[model samples]
Target: MMSFDLIGRLFGSVRDRDGRADVLEKLAQHEPTLPAPRNPSAPEELLPVALATKVLAGWLANRQQTLVPHTLNFRVLGPAQADLLLAVMAAAIQADGEIDSREARQLSLALRRVGAGEDEARRIGAMLAEPQHLGTLLTRIQEADLATHAYAAALLAINRGTRVNRAFLDYVSARLGLVPDVAGSLERRYRA
Candidate 1:
């Protein structure tokens, strides 16, 4: 129920007197109550669909369980794909979203399951610790080469399942300027 003016007094950014006055007048006329305040820098507050796709891609490509017991290999993915996925995974885990401990454990196990050695896994874990914006991370994914794009799209489709709608596929394909078949193939290959 606190007024904007009241909250603004404590929060320094709402300093424009005339603008604040207009806002206050509108609030007074409406007699509105304060909405939930958001943390300006919290990762959880921002989960743009694009960013979520990137995170899901990283989790699948680098963390999914494989059928064959292959030796842990960081070389399996190129640098661009690896970097993009690492950033997104870190952001998702930190996003004010709930990541069950079991899921976290599974993700850890999957990281090992992919045959990622201790050093590589630790390095990737370090990358996940780096602070990054979701938009920036998504930009990296969007900018990858065709091979990286194919791999990432496959992982995304697998992790997102039915959530990977036509609109989302089109968006990713358009961003890559790739043929629809490429994206479709990825979806088929990684069908959940």
Candidate 2:
């Protein structure tokens, strides 16, 4: 089975400047590896049950697919991993050194959507209510995709009529080990 770590590295490599050409070269040189199917019977302790259920439900809803609860295919994220993802996002929301009502609402909605308990969500909120250091939060990610997604989420929070700091963005991209172009693309897409 292709491990998540390996998958993350592969994704990072392919997200570089010559990503498409690199992918074609990789395909020509070797057989592509596929990820293992999501095993519903696998232990669910990796992710909190409520969170996992919510993720599965959202995925199904997006695809307009219906399946019995017990038979749904969902990838389970470790509790620590999930927490790190949320923390990174929280840091992003607070990246500009302030969290307005709109940002707070966005964070609350995100926490609820992920099925976080009030106490846990509040803890995260409290931590982010203060000034956040991008490097500190980016250090928590072990996977490139997680860092990328978290950064994307944070950018969304501050991309409205606000001046984004280029240095902060560059620092974050470097801390997360993302290709420069990927960060550039995100900046172009989200910059107001």
lDDT of 2 by residue, 110-192 (tens): 55554555765766766675655656567656343476555554554443455553455556678777676566555555443
Stretches > 4 Å off in candidate 2: 1-75, 112-120, 129-133, 142-145, 165-167, 180-192
Model 1: residues >4 Å from true position, as ranges? 1-73, 76-81, 91-96, 109-115, 142-174, 177-180
In candidate 2 the C-alpha lDDT for residue 107 amounts to: 65
Name the best candidate (by TM-score): 2
In order, the Cα lDDT scores of the candidates are 0.51, 0.57
TM-score of each: 0.38, 0.44
